[model samples]
Target: MQKIISASNFADIMGVSKATLQKWETNGAFVPSIDPAGRKFFYVEKLLGVPEISDMVQSSWEEEMQVNPLRSYTSIELFAGAGGLALGLEKAGFSHILLNEIDHDACVTLQYNRPEWRVVEQDVRTISFKQFNGKVDFLSGGFPCQAFSYAGKQGGFNDTRGTLFFELARAVKEIQPKVFMGENVKGLAAHDGGRTLETIRNTIAELGYTLIEPRVLKAIFYQVPQKRERLILVAIRNDIADKVQFKWPDPYHRIMTLRDAFFKGELYDTDVPPSEGQTYPLKKQKVMELVPMGGYWRDLPLDVQKEYMGGSFELEGGKTGMARRLSLDEPSLTLTCAPAQKQTERCHPTETRPLTVREYARIQTFPDEWKFAGTLSSQYKQIGNAVPVNLAYAVGRSLIRLFNDIESL
Candidate 1:
């Protein structure tokens, strides 16, 4: 039987106020067991089922996704920014034969960290992947989302020309990999009123690959300590699609907190290593100091809110990100390239400053020793653009499972 904890004790453990816990209970976010004496209590095992708690604990951070038993399987990655996906795949036991990216800084970072990876710094359209036909196991990319020129016809491979996604599909056709994975911002599902994604699905079908129902994986549910989400599209060679079955990774049992990312804890053996970071102007720092942990622009005095928010104060909608300080008690907000940007502030929980570069990397689940190369701004961009390493690991493991099933047949 699982141990039972009192409501107050559970609240303390979660670092949330009792009122907040009650509110969550009221909303059915969590439920507690009742004792015969009328005391409310919760089972730790049951608490793990809560999306916020269970998801974090069971998320991909701690375990290695299953590895392919094959002696060797190669991969080619396109638009491989800062290697978040690549790193996770590597951790899950995939070998990189080639990786292509247009950004010079990202290429430099890749080469700096793993000299073994074949880094092709060039435009995807200009590159020819035909030489690798039937030689690669997987072709993956996080292609940028762009509107397609539908031309009012059934959009297929030809109509997708001029978009980055075309290059991804082109590579899949050229390499003839057993599997291909494409990831993008969640909005891709609804982009252009869903026509764009529908076209992608149809294009993959035309290329003779079986498309799996694409899904949007919320990073938070996958053990990334941020609220980031990505849309994943997978396709398998038609010959073996029926022989293989693919399953998305299970959600973690607990949510990682900001403290888990920064402090010496399960995620890291030691505190974050020292690294360069951007700083706020003196005036901005003073203003931020007044903002408490988990507080945002709304916490500021009326005059301060007006001054800090400028015209945004009068604007409608919840400008929630403004002057937002992360809560140490909870997972951090999704990070952006510019932490101090007014529209998407990610203020440090305790300090009146932006998270350092290493801190940013930690939140993105980058390994501690995985060094980044570039100016501070460039590094921030690299970290911000990376797929959370843990999430990639989960996807990598799933790919391995598919590969194994195919090989066994």
Candidate 2:
């Protein structure tokens, strides 16, 4: 299929400026057809044939292509927001013993989607995982990032008491799973100037688990069509860590885009199914209508720009996300809980509106049949808060491989 790429996206991909692209086209080096509206459309075949583009298209790191679990490995997840991580691991053949989530709507979403799975709808701190000790193969959590209290001691697990992470760390101590992983925003690696991570590292060691130096996994590098990043902290039981080696999941060969998320293409068998979505007010809609696909507020005319960005107009940083439109040919920006938020606008690529609930699900790589149960806002929050399913699947495969190695020995 032909992609009517925005000039900005094309220029960025081809390592040329808009002017340079125009010049190259005039010189007959490479040219794309221009629509009546003056937007450029390029053939995907020609785009991939470029030496620079070809390299990225050729390189692949999808772990499942090479690795498979030896058996039905079991897992339990805490703080399982919307089942993105759970579903991915399920796809990797991990039978979940239990999945815990706090939000009522999210719990319903999970229970509605997977009635057969155990859905614990309570706070993590109140639950005891002792029963599952040494039973589950993996334990995972996308614990919220909260600052630890540095009151009395050198911020160990105690300092993080009352925090959700403490609950995850508690589960690890109680369950003594073979491998435990905690995922959070990339900024966690440097949270509180790295002191927080030091505390987390020390806490994991104290719990008798050895942490593989935490690494941030970019969603776009996997099969996800968003630029979201997660800081993954995977630790192995001290007894087995020495006998096993953990490997990070590899990236997919080519990057996916909004096209893959919304249209019938490689990522989905059919186009996105219509679902509930938010709409902008008349005033906001008019302003957004001026934004070209892939362009942001800065692309608007100066007067409108000044009017639209009253306080932030004089700001130093680009503030590029304001009033932005997504690009069909590029991975979307990290989605926020509210798609229409002022600072982190996630506008649809072709339409001047927020992404639909299904579109948001699609971007996170949730399977088509998995339905979210809640108010529209709740659904968006669940999807936005999720770790992309494809990224989680990639990590799940790596965990399986590591477990396989441990079992072999």
lDDT for model 1, please: 0.85
Across residues 1-409, which tens digit of lDDT does each residue of candidate 2 receive?
2234455555555545567888988998777877797767665567776764554455555335667878888899998989999999888778998999989998998999999999999978788888987888889999989888876466787888888888999999899889999999998988899888888987898899999988988787678988788999999998898887888876565567899899998899999999889999999999999999989999999999999999999989878789999989788888999899989999999998999999999999999898887889989999999989999899988888888888788
Predicted model with the maximum TM-score: 1
Q: Which ten residues in a row have the lowest lDDT in candidate 2?
A: 1-10
How do all models score by TM-score? 0.88, 0.87
Stretches of candidate 2 off by over 4 Å are: 1-63, 151-154
**Global lDDT scores for all candidate models:** 0.85, 0.85
Candidate 2 colliding pairs: 61-250
